[model samples]
Target: MANGTGVAGASAATASEGAFLEVAGLGVTFGGLTALSGFGLNLEQGRLLGIIGPNGAGKTTLFNLLTGLVRPTTGSVVLEGRDITGAKPHVLADAGVARTFQNIRNIRGLSVIDNVKVALGLHESPSLLSTIFFTPAYRSGQFRTEQKARTLLQLLNLDDVRNLPGDGLPYGAQRRLEIACALALEPKLLLLDEPAAGMNPTETIELMELIKRVHREFGLTIMLIEHNVHFIMNTCERIQVLNYGQLIADGEPSYIRKHPAVIEAYLGAGAHDA
Candidate 1:
């Protein structure tokens, strides 16, 4: 077990060759409880990585740390050679990081398009005075924003229900809509937490293809936390396993599937029985 201290002395280092994102000696504690400890990994540009663990394994906590939802008790987060540890969420967003939550988060009252617009609005820098007077610049900016939003919706295959309320869509579409909203941030790194949580086998398979398409089309470096072993095994290029807030294994899917520590600690004894 990692105890609360996590991996020790995982310090920020010179960017590794092709290292787009890196975290070293990352640990977090809530009072006496240890959420994560000694957690560290490197993500290359344009690679899709998956994190898997049993419940209470501090998976969501890691996502929170990456997106600036909470600060870590120890360690550093580096993105493209910049030390972004403890940066605020908005600051991280500005720095090209975006994420979708484990639960669907969207403006249920707002149309699907408007949900995306909210994300775009966060990074807009139009002068308030121009908007007060309805200046051409503001109008033009809004027009361009809408056009880009539409393009993103189309890319994610959500354009058909662009006018529907986000909450009105079926569970899977709502998940896709959330991803579209994240895309509006124009992120270089996108974190998806449990994207296939409620989908059936067919939907999950479809989502797997969609994820691959998104990664190829956008040229993004993506990381996801998913509970579905089959989904992660099939989708991600590399896999990291977590148990008791510690990284028990990290490797390609084939290696991960057979790692003894992973099977004993999290994957369970019967994992290979079938």
Candidate 2:
């Protein structure tokens, strides 16, 4: 559904107009092999976008590039009009970017609430002197942080297990916990990489609803990478298809579903009716 001329013209317009998250001519290579090439995107604020491709389509690589886990070989990443290319992960976090991994990465021994608290602490920690002296200010801050963590837990439906160890939670709840922790950062842009990777059908459906709720309640711009075509087609307002590090389609679900290249590359020939 995406033609080179249209995409290029859109990229040019978005660059000058200042998109919320703008990427242009993004490319990455490891050694001599190209992992991603000529990637460009312009994500407006408060939109839920999905990226889908087969394995090794550079989905994770794109996330890595955006989060500053990897540097691009060419191009720029701009967030809210500020160039963030090559920014460190912590710097990106401070700049209001947050993400969850394909695999859950909760703190193994930390309480579920504590995991969220830790992320909040990064942005709202008390002064060292106050903490060392156990000052009333520090105590008050801790209480406030705990309350905030509890609210996030409740939002993710993990309040009942707030005291339980993060890694000790069931797989589905652990995934939710990871999302809660990311939300604890109060990010403006949230990137979810295969949040439903191992979820059962019911869990996947629930996760889809939760994602929609979060987007609505928090008014956050989100980008998701997933292999589940059905989930992406249902949840995302706009979708992009990639193959061998190249984008083949970009449009609404109906358009992407019917795109010849998308069907051939990832959705298969039978997906014409999808």
Candidate 3:
């Protein structure tokens, strides 16, 4: 996992294959308290990055800041070399970033295909007027987009239930469907918040493989926040550990597992190198 997801060494910029996203000096505050401080990260394209830490470490809060679900009091979010700090959620989506919630939030009543279509239409639609008329060009565009959606569904092994309501699919399938919805946006960067949450061990393993395949097959740059330390270590190339709203460690998993500060602050004294 470290081999696949590791951050490029210092001099990441000059290393060629530069970072797709660079988060620098990110800090978040609520009321009088700080939720994240001096936190930063560099994400290379087509890699998987794991964000992990003990509870209240601000791992999810940092993700919130990245996705613009919550604004950081101070910091800048750079995507594909563009400043996007404080950008609205929809703006970020339009800027080639897509994310999924840890909790299941896909449209429960929509058929699986329609759910994916809704997200795809945002990017592929030629015009609102065209869609309203169902003109040849409009219908033709929608057909191609739907075909892409169906192909993605099949690639995710979800076609067997393509016509099923989102809520009717099994839990594991629903999670994959949520990822499919994110993919429908044709995003360059994907943020997955605990895609394996609430899954059995078998399902978790499969999900990890699916994530890797997404990176390999689609060459997506991914940032993920996961509670399962072992799984994250096994799936992410490099990881960032947060503690009490501060960055405690950032490096390849092997280095982090042995970092004394990370052990004491985020992983606890009992955690060891994988």
lDDT of each: 0.87, 0.88, 0.82
Report the error of model 3 at residue 19, Å. 3.3
Residue-wise C-alpha lDDT for candidate 3, range 1-274, written one tens digit per residue: 2323232232333423446787767888899889988776777788888888888888888878877899989867788878889998878888888998888888987999889998987777687787777789988888898799889999889988999998788899999999999998889999998999999999999999999989888888898889898899999888887788877778798987777777787545766543
Model 1 agreement with the true structure over 25-126: per-residue lDDT tens digits: 888999999999988887789999999988999999999999999999988999988889999999999999999989899898899998999889877768
- Model 2, 56-116: lDDT tens digits are 9999999999999999988888899889998999999989999999988999879999999
Best-to-worst order by TM-score is 2, 1, 3
Q: What is the lDDT of residue 96 in candidate 3?
A: 86
Candidate 1 regions with alpha-carbon error over 4 angstroms: 1-18, 267-274
Which candidate wins on lDDT? 2
- How much RMSD separates candidate 3 from the native structure? 3.9
In model 1, state the lDDT of residue 68.
96
Model 2 residue 11 CA deviation (Å) reads 5.5
What is the lDDT ranking, best to worst? 2, 1, 3
